[model samples]
Target: MDGCALLPVNSPGHLPSHHEVTRFHCHSDSEDEYVIIELEDLENLSVAPDKRSSFEPGSNSAEATAQELCRAFRKYWLQTDSAVQLSDCLSSSKQRSVRKEEIPRELESSLNLAEEIKIISKLRGSSGWSPPRSQIIFNIHPSVKRDAVVAAQNFTCVGCGTPIESKYIRRLRYCDYLGKYFCDCCHSYAQSSIPARILSKWDFKKYYVCNFSKHLLDSIWQHPIFNVSCINKTLYTKSKEMDRVREAQEQLFHLKKLLKTCRFAESVLKEFEQVPSHLTEELHLFSLDDLVKIKRGQLLPLLKDILKSSTSHVDGCELCQAKGFICEFCQSADLLFPYQTAKCKRCPECKTCFHKACFKYGGCPKCLRISARRTLSETPSLVPQ
Candidate 1:
């Protein structure tokens, strides 16, 4: 009678059997409302505390009154349990929702709980619950889609073989030559952490220079030209070697322009024009007479040796001992000396010292010859007929 106390059959505490009818209060709060429930009606109700018997409330039988009371208790318990469970679920959902910030900006607006759960499942295995397929709307990037396809085949990072997941796919970077996808961490290390010696061996065309800017390309040509032997020994890939050679040729072309500005160099270049436009072909075809004249003539001192100076002296003359000859006009020691065997030239007219390489293309930067600019017909061809 008080606060959900169950009445047992044949107990002394219950209403005496002589009393055919008893008044039962459904709830403690309402003292005015009382239902007439009989002892037999209580006994007829099922044993389960929450289950309500089918006995109808409107029926004229004593069991009807008992059924009404049982139904009220059952409804109260069900509502209480549901409210508690829902509260717990909401708290858990809030915790899981915190990860939404990590999603890419492009996908943020369209993301939903169902799609999030699906992505989480893919990354960290299933959580034993799956939402309907129609609810999941994926609008991922092309790169992510490609990664997903690759992950389906390999199930791991292409570079390190770590298990591929949705999170990793979002941050992945690709290597074209390697033809594989790498994790973000590993890709970053490859770009900045690798040693220069090892990095030099990588294919410049395929891997390194693929994303080069115009400034970077020009810088390659502007930098001091490396020896062919050095480049050949260092670069293992054919593409890289070709890139080095091409850059070196471009640098040489620029150097030729500087040479043409001088009257003496202009004359030497005019002599060179008869051989061919390409320097490599002309070098191969040069006769012994040409070499003899180039070595001994005043023109030898004008050709700048662009090589860097070495600290130690090797076998040869003062120009060779200096490692590289300097150009007086440029006032920089960075000029290249092509002939290692040649000697330095001191101009008798100006008493200025010049490298053979510098004098060959152009006389001293200060001494311009009016005759050096004579018409091509007036200048005799250095090539033997």
Candidate 2:
């Protein structure tokens, strides 16, 4: 029930006038005039990256203060049911008389009872509720003593070598039919004691199942029962890994079976044969002597023709030109501007129509660039794949 209170920084109206005046004075500091910029209108305050520091300090102390305030408020807002159950346990313990030496024992019991009560109370408080039985035997069977049951069962379940969790017995009809000191749920579900001979059979069964699951590479090792290991954790890990290997083996076996059924050997070979073994690349080329090189008259006409041909063939924006790239931000493309694709990607400048990809070039353009494609249908040719 013990808790603390905190006054919210934003809830200044609830505070006395003196406290409010103090807060105002702290914020309205004149000595540190440069640090204190008056945001008369909070809306006018710029959240731009450059202007942020003048407002919020962004410090650890500020963060811690905010967290502490939240915790204090949460304490006031939330109510837990344990407060009532704790009171009940203490009251019950007070009514019981005990010897001086037994005081410690009594206190321990009370603490445990309080814990159980708290659990139940919390469960009931939740929207969907379920309850466990009121009585729980700590270490011994309800009807049998620890040693007697262990002796009869040979310190292990006759049905399975898995040892019982605890010697504590809970009294119930037909419990003796099963070997003594079985886990409560197991005892109830099985409805009889497991005999020593039956336990040996179970051991054999477990060994076979465990080995099979491993050898076959089954995913069954994830089960909770399989998780319980007789050996140390290190060995248990090795055991599970073995299971995974077995699962892989099983998968391979199934794949083989599928392959056999599908007659993969015959079809697989045929498919391999169909793949091309070699590629041919040959093109006619003119001799260097025959290649016409240079006069401006011929060059200009050819250049113009080439540009016209490129414009008709290329698909790009009229504004940017299909020069081989386009600006991402502006998304401009044309014959003069670059056409953009993965390997040929470029960014076109806004005003100058400069391709950002062409960083080697200095500021001024040597010649004007032109558009390539006016429309999608006007796209000339698909590049060879």
Candidate 3:
């Protein structure tokens, strides 16, 4: 109750008294009500008697500089800390960006996906719900092909040109991900599941990877670079768990859109601090980290928990509830959101949500209208102009 007191009562579910709401508003509003509180705090600071002077000519240079910096910080915070745009607040932020190694200048750019990520991570963050999965190009090297085998054979280390002393004595380590050879110091016999093999062939076998490739993978483990819908649509049919997780992710995506747009849902967003951020920020994209979680059978449960909390917030917020969809098919009084998996089914073509039972009878009205419009446009006029 005390923590909830910080925010205004947009729609406190069962609160019966205006008195409590008034008290909370008074407590929070008290700061604003006392406009000179900050000034008074400065005046009342407990300065040592010896250091204090009754009539000081002016504040010292350090004090002036500190006041200026404080003002600037305050201005910046006020400008950015409102109901910010979804893009501005929800953009993908990775903890580390792989700095290109001088020895292997093309290490980060060796694969198309790697290069694309470098560009994206460097540029101003994208504003879309999820990056287009179709645009992600995976460069998986064929191991057995003659040309591929021949090209991979290098007399020197791929990292630093450290030549092999003897073929049998000190063999070079082959990195499956980069399809290159490295010396002992550069390789360290590190092994990890390759993203290329995972995305293209759905293979999860561990293989030897160079230190550079391992670090690179680790850095982008949580970056949304894979688009299973575009890359391997058949995987969903093959893996029921993946499909389920995808559906849950879609629901969370819809929920995030609502929570982000509602001006009264700021505290609700703060609740997401302890959870995986990718679930809310990117809709259709999956990170290597997410894939790992799915492999471990842990992603769905986590997503479900997130979904429960997010939906609860959207339902409780009056501003978010105002935007809820009324079932056009049955004309039901009940308000529906696309995230309500039990109640609503979203139209694949037009992306409209309706009660599942109602949809079974009426079909998608928007899709039918679109089809009719298309047919009318395609048909030629019988009479000449």
Candidate 4:
């Protein structure tokens, strides 16, 4: 009378007398003996074969239904007997098992069952549920694939010598010269700029020499004249003493070719011719005797000076006129004395000329200024207001 029993709700006379019953045993806290009763398999009997197949042990829907049934049974049982003490039967069974390896297998099976239940719950709807097409659930984390790639490759950046994160591995580049992978920072420097000055000569030769010609050409185009003033002047003088003129001459020949290729040779030669002999005594290697024949080593400094002075003079000459054969200062060609009308006025003192507009603006070289001032003081009425 204290035990529970399950009986079929409706039994017909035509039905077989022998029906299957599943028995379960439970003991009260005060009693040592166990009580058992025949229980009808309500789920097997009420559910159709096709419907029951969906809740089989291997199916996700089955796992979900089983969990729901367990919860409902526990709730109903607790309602019936408030004094009944409930414990986790599954955990107790696991603790009682002696096989260590079997315990891990059981835990893994439980985890799989829980995962299937979760997946089934997500896929379930009012229209009824269907098994997910993919058996393995894909992780939604954005970095999952990237992390897998990094782990598989075990990639480390050559530049920083650090393990590269999976997300940043795509940003790495390969350098043929160094024969290694480089991070963004080092790869950009290698591709876009010259090797750092801190790099040793051997390293420069090894890692940078392959692209030196390109870098040199780019530098020359950007800045036509190479400035060597930063170098020790004594080095040049010492080379001359050592009779390394052949090397210097060879370099000069190559330099001339470069200037000519860049369409600067003619202008550079003309500028060199105008330079004073005294000022170039230190750079005597670039003698004016043959402007066409000079070493680039000697011409380098002169070219820098020309570019600098030309830029300054052009900027300073506010009244500079268009280049022509007419006199810049007088702006007159004496038809009566055609022979005396020189193409340009060469100031004796400064060896410079002033355009007519420049003369009007009081921009005449110092040598011509003294004579003009004296003449102006002599004939005040002739001076324009």
Q: Pick the candidate with the highest lDDT.
A: 3
User: What TM-score does each of the candidates earn?
Assistant: 0.18, 0.17, 0.52, 0.18
Descending-lDDT candidate ranking: 3, 1, 4, 2
Q: Per-residue alpha-carbon lDDT of model 3 for 1-385, expressed as tens digits?
A: 1111111112323333321111100001121111000111121132222323221223242243224323332332112221233233112111111222112212332344444434433441332111001111144543443222212232344444343444422355677766666556556787888776676566777888766566545545665645565344566776777888878877776787778898877876776655577655655467777777787888888777777778788778788888888888888789999778778887766778889888853467888888899999999989898
Deviation of model 4 at 290, angstroms: 19
lDDT per residue as tens, model 1, 114-179: 565455456543422111111001111223345433433243443334556565465555533223
- Estimate the TM-score for candidate 3: 0.52
lDDT (10s digit) by residue, model 4, range 1-385: 1111211123322433332222212211112111111112433433333443222222343233233333333332212221122233223323433322200101122234445334433443222222111110001112223323223223444333345655666665544332334445334433422222101110112232112222222222221111111111233443442124323333333233334343324565455455443222222222112221222245445545654544343334332212223544565652111111123233445645444233433355465577888988887595477
Runs in model 2 with CA error above 4 Å?
Answer: 1-112, 126-254, 257-261, 264-385
Which has the greatest TM-score?
3
**Candidate 1 Cα misplacement greater than 4 A, ranges:** 1-145, 148-153, 166-168, 189-303, 306-385
Worst 10 residues of 1 by lDDT: 130-139
Number of the candidate with higher lDDT, 1 or 2: 1
Winner on TM-score between 1 and 3 is: 3
lDDT of 2 by residue, 1-385 (tens): 1111111112222323221111100011122111111112121121222332221223232233223322332232112221233234233323331212200111222234445435433543432111111110111113434444343333333222343434332321123322133332223232211111111111111111111112111211111111111101122234343333223222222222323333323443232222111100001111111111111122223323433333343333232122233333345653223222222322234234344454333333322232322454578669875
